[model samples]
Target chain A: MSSEYDTTETLDVKGQSCPMPIVKTKQAIDGLEAGNVLEVVATDSGSISDIQGWADGTDGVELLEQVEGDDLYTHYVKKTE
Target chain B: MSTDNPTTSVDDADSEVDAAELQALRERVEELEASMAAVDDGDDQQKMTIVATQGSFDMAYPPLILASTAAAFGWEVIVFHTFWGLDILHEEKSQDLKLSAVGNPNMPMPNALAALPGMDAMATKMMQKKIDENGTATIEELIDVSLESGVDLQACQMTIELMEYDEDDFYDGVTTGVGAATAIQHMAESDVQLLV
Candidate 1:
């Protein structure tokens, strides 16, 4: 069975540092249509907190599922209008 | 024909004018150099001034971190907050700003390493303390350093209305209702422009 919040977009932000990841992710969010979802994978430790903070601050962006593994972070966030 | 004269000269009028202009520029440069050397040799510990622009809470740290540390190193540092970054201009709100991590699992935060079950709150508090220890200078310290070193701090007026924050919500060094044009002008005057 597929997860409820499936990945509609994938952003690879590896090896990049703080602010760049957030900046790029914000661009992604802007491009996304409401009700869609995005799967984000990153190696930066700051992205987790930054993305969550951004997702909370805006409307129609819902972080639906989160799974943290050994070396990276995987998140599925749905777009909500 | 070969126009191969190595020192091909200009006409007398143009050559005379160019020579005079060059001489004047050279003399002015020498005077400037002497003044700079005097300032450098003297005990006047002021010259460089920087204006920092911080728009968000997360965006707040880099500017403060850089400015306070720059101040510690004896460079004049100013932090200008326009929008959400101004939230930290107040001692109370600044101390309480936390990162929300439910869907944003990619904030490049060190707390992600703690990935313990429900460790986000702990991670956030720890992050705050870490930032403090890292000379992630507080808004209060920024104000103090700014005052001591003649640094000017201003808040963007338009951002104030967008966020519905009042002037009374800021610290003593904080000036509210400044326009972006002013900040842009300051940034233009600065040798560096960081968008944090």
Candidate 2:
């Protein structure tokens, strides 16, 4: 799926379960500079809410967009200072 | 007459109102200070401490799962292994941790099948396979991930001493051997504390 926002990096966490996807996503986002967009693609069904909740709880990160495709979910997040 | 002092009466009323307002402001300040103090006490909302007391394959997952997940959330996670739970931290014994199907209510089959001679081994293999198929990290992998993410892994000193197990018996990531007091300190500091 296409994201309106330009992503600086894409983290593919496909086939990973609940916490692993979130964990890897967090780690991936941590490496990027502020204002960079991270596109996290995952097959875990729970990643939809998990990523949203993670973004909500975390500071300096904003959920820009979410795209759901067949058996896959992509989360677009922008890191803010 | 006192009624003639109208300005004085007005001033007196104004002063009484001022006094009440001052009291209310003081009370509000005190309440805010109390809450701030509570927050400063390090209720450790961003920290988690888990006590792992069981070593079975079924039992080993909880602490590792929680510790890793908590670390994933950017929380400071600590897992304290005591007694049988230390087996998960042991280099060799960890591989031997087995799931017993005989009395497990969650086992699909009847007790007759579960009671078969080698069923425990079968159940353990099944459990491990299911964990692998589900994309869940193994206990060893979880421990490694947790450590790499800065989760603190501690062994119970009392148990280690009682068991006569050397520190070499545990995996590389086991950071410290601490007594109940240290574990209790972690629990007290953590907002999310679990005994598994």
Candidate 3:
């Protein structure tokens, strides 16, 4: 997943559900500089929509890509103020 | 000559009226578009308000979950805990809130069995186990997440007085003794208002 897109940081939130994935994602994204890409790996099936919806509604962040791989959901998000 | 061109005069008059109306409509569209663009770029944070009326372990999850989730989405969140929901903010009661099977249609057991002594406690224990197994955030953890995410957790003032709960019974970040009028004002402006 890292090979697909250059990521500044990767957050793995496996075995966590509802709001935790997004909560932790927001926290991680907050630490990155503008234009830095964050890669998030989540086990929750809902993270796909959760992260996408969160990024869509939230300012200063953009979801670049989302990939589902072998029971894991991966998302590439960019900080765009 | 004028009588012969009466139809042309009517057509000219209609064309002039249409031109004026079209210009007015075009200006209105431009104003609307500009305002819409401003909204898209402005700091218009979405707001969500929830009224939590139940204190059961099961019922407690919904309001907190939605509040934290909305906060995660960068929306302003407010949760008003009233009546039995006061247990959710009570320092000790929050950890001990029970899931009563009695009179609950969702409980798989028959009503008679649900009414048996220790049934509610057993159900609550089982639910807690499931929650742990699912890796779901506990009520305490959710409260912390909500507070850290800037969700406003309000405890109803009337409920506090009626239940005789001390001011210190709630968690640290809670906005205790908030009035219904205050909650109503928030709800009125909230983009989403829920009764959970």
* DockQ scores for all predicted structures: 0.02, 0.45, 0.63
TM-score of chain A of 1: 0.83
Candidate 1, residue B93: lDDT: 77
For model 2, the superposed segments whose C-alpha errors exceed 4 Å read: B1-45
Model 1, position B17, has a per-residue lDDT of 96
The lDDT leader among the candidates is 3
- In the range B1-196, model 3's lDDT, one tens digit per residue, is 7567888899999999999999999999999999998997554878999999999999999999999989988889999999999899999999999999999998999999999999999999999999889889899999999999999999999999999999899999999869899999999989999998
TM-score of chain A of each: 0.83, 0.95, 0.95
Task: Please tell me which predicted candidate would have the highest DockQ against the true structure.
Answer: 3
TM-score of chain B of 2: 0.74
The digit string of per-residue lDDT tens for model 1 on B1-196 reads 2575535554656789999999999999999999999987554333233444443345556676455434433444455676567776765677666555444556554544545565566556666776655434454554564555445666777877887777787777677767877776766555455666
Enumerate residue pairs that collide in model 2: none
**DockQ category of candidate 2:** acceptable
Q: Over all chains combined, what TM-score does candidate 3 have? A: 0.84
Error of 3 at B36 (Å): 9.3
**What tens-digit string does per-residue lDDT give for candidate 2 at B85-126?**
988888888888999898788999898999999999999999
Q: What is the TM-score of model 1 when looking only at chain B?
A: 0.58
Fnat across every predicted model, in order: 0.00, 0.43, 0.83
